[model samples]
Target: MTLPVDLETDAARLRAIMAEDLAVRGVLDDPAWRAAVEAVPRHRFAPGFYLPGEERDGLGLTVWQPVTAALDPGRWLAAAYSDTTLITQFDGDEPDWEHPAERHGGAPTSSSTLPSLVVRMWADADVREGHTVLEIGTGTGYSTALACERLGSAGVTSVDVDPYRLERAASSLHGCGYAPTLAVADGVYGYWPEAPFDRIVAACSFRAVPPALVAQTRPGGKILLTLSGWLYGYARVLLTVSGDGTAEGCLLGGTVSFMSARTHAAPAFGNPAHWAAELPGEARDARHGPERITAATEEAFHLRFLVQSAVPGAQLATVGDVVHLVDVVSGSAATLTPDCEGGWRVREGGPVRLWESVERVVDVYEAAGRPGSESFTLSVHHGGQHLRHPRVPCLPLPSPEGRPGRSRTASGRTGHSSSQLARE
Candidate 1:
């Protein structure tokens, strides 16, 4: 295929814009990263992608518009360099046609993560010359290309579970004039042949850090990944592997949403136990104080992350004003209903009161001062992982004086006004 001169010019222009955006956001301070961002032609890798659209049906599925260079070259080039995640594969399948009249709707199984986020992650990983980096989930090879540019092709090894993705990424990397070692293997196992990697970064989120990844990393090496689960909450963590294979690290300040590791795609929220559990004999009505406490946490992302972290395998769902808590492993279920007068009614079923557990944890989080994920530390041991906070710290709340659209000061410690919480 012959290259179009105008397309190359447009791609360069867009790349510059993306670099500026990232720099303004304070994520692209590294000159080498900026140079790589400008040098690589992103459009070559993402020849076609899906633009997530509205839900076409009531099943909560989103309609995705497929953008191809042939169909609309201008739009395609624009999307290629835009600072947003581009869906590369849907429902684990690639689009069959170059251009289709109708749109498709399904979950995104692969994507080119937003350029800014990718660069931010690279910065967080602290990739440097001579560092042997192993990247998990090389979806479209865009990030892989960046790593190769910064660390040289021989310094990076990229792996993915999908054979098709590996083949496509290998082709893309080659076209861009760089060929990093690409492998088709389960990322959870962490490419054992390339053991003792100096740095490991995962594009996919994990319910817990894979033991194999910890084992493969050199002692004092950095391992960056997101800890996410069924509830869809996330905490970016950077752990330092110990000589014994145990890693301890705290959550990064902000939350990042990434696809769950293929091997750890949590069980369905309706895990059979929720249906088989028996109801408690009598339901208890939570008092006003507890009601307010529970309601306050409903819209707080940090609090939700903390709750999900403490109660592994716990899932939460909300309908109208009521929130449901369930634990499939223990066959426990609980529901909270608001009485519209500052109090909530609680119902318990199964072997345990899941809502009570959630409530107690919420209290502990509150007592700790509602600290964000940054305040919590995770210790991954042999059997399981443990999340702990040294002191009860309050999460940085939205500023009370600030309006809905206004930004706050450096210290992010303002609580949202009562009205804002209610509206949410």
Candidate 2:
């Protein structure tokens, strides 16, 4: 009863709208980036996605329903061209084939990342005409397509841990007339076969730059990755590898949280018995005012980084006025509560005196003028990587204070649990 819609005209209109939005915000300034954005047909990559409904469910939960070309082609194409992230995969839950109309609920495991963020990272990587770019975490292959359009398909190499994703991406890339190299491998190790890459950009986040990534990069090559911690705080960095095998760079201002690399994810959290096993190790009292670091504000960004650098693998969860800190590596846990007086009380356990370190680091950071990301620089060595600032003292990457023998996956490779990792 209905004629086929003119997809090209519709896609072009939406692309222009996206470009205008980016230009007005001063994000699409690079001619190459602009050309790539305009040329690539984003709708080809995301055949189906979940869009969160404006209304809440009876239980006050956000409703996310799938939209596909068969269900609603026009709306689907519009969303594909929008600037928002499109959810492509849900973790932990599988679709119910019996109830085809049912909507599944779970954490978003993969997605088409926001276009602006992707371009920003590409810009930071300094991807140029003749540069060979190795893109880690090739979700949906949208970024790979962009790189292929900007440079040549021969200059782009993309790798992802999931073979299923790589297969889908390959089809999408081929559909768009791009045949960039696609590999099914762990991004943590980077692709050694494609070594000496001029530009390396990771769409995923990790606590530290993998030494292998640095070794595979050509001298003076640039690397960009979202530097994230278990605290869930993150910042972007673009480091230039030197002949000495050290890459130093400053953190880009503004927060960015990507799915943690699969190999870097932590094990099961929220197991009551897990915490119960370590509660009898130690007990501690108030060390200092937790508000000096726990208060949520723009200024607290540096303070969060301070705690992450000091404690290594600390994760934070706040309930009411109390902040809970747990380290899977060290089995250390601490509960910080605001004291009636303007100070704070700390109850600690396990081998690590996390509260004492927090107090000491806060003092040092404050004395150093509470430097921001601009003052922070990364120094990646073969042994480890440490974040340093001119004003704040150098903090070496601490041993991942997690439980030994619990970090590796069944494949006998170093891998984290599903809880601590995401791919999209």
- lDDT score, candidate 1, position 274: 46
Candidate 1: how large is its RMSD? 10.2
Write down the lDDT of every candidate, Cα atoms only: 0.72, 0.75
How do the predictions measure up, each by TM-score?
Answer: 0.84, 0.85
Q: Looking at model 2, report the run of 10 residues with the lowest lDDT sum.
A: 415-424
lDDT of 2 by residue, 1-424 (tens): 1225687788877888897788789888998899899999888888777889888788666688887777887888889998889887777243342232434356676789989988888987888899998999998899899999999999999999887778888999998899898899888889998788999999988777777788889999999998666665667888999999888888888766788786676555685345545565444457566666556775676577656666665677766677777777656677776766766666776556566667777777778877777778877766556677766667654332222222544455542221121111
Q: For this target, which candidate reaches the highest TM-score against the unseen true structure? A: 2
lDDT of 1 by residue, 1-424 (tens): 2358878887888899988888888889999999999888888788788887655656555677888888888988888888889888876876664554445566678999989888989999888999999999999899999999999999899999999988888888998789888899888888988777999999998776778888899999999998776556677899998998788887787757899777777566563334424555566776323333234443365666555543444566766676666665544567776777767787776544555655666676666676666767777766346666677422221111111112232234332111111111
Error of 1 at 310 (Å): 3.3
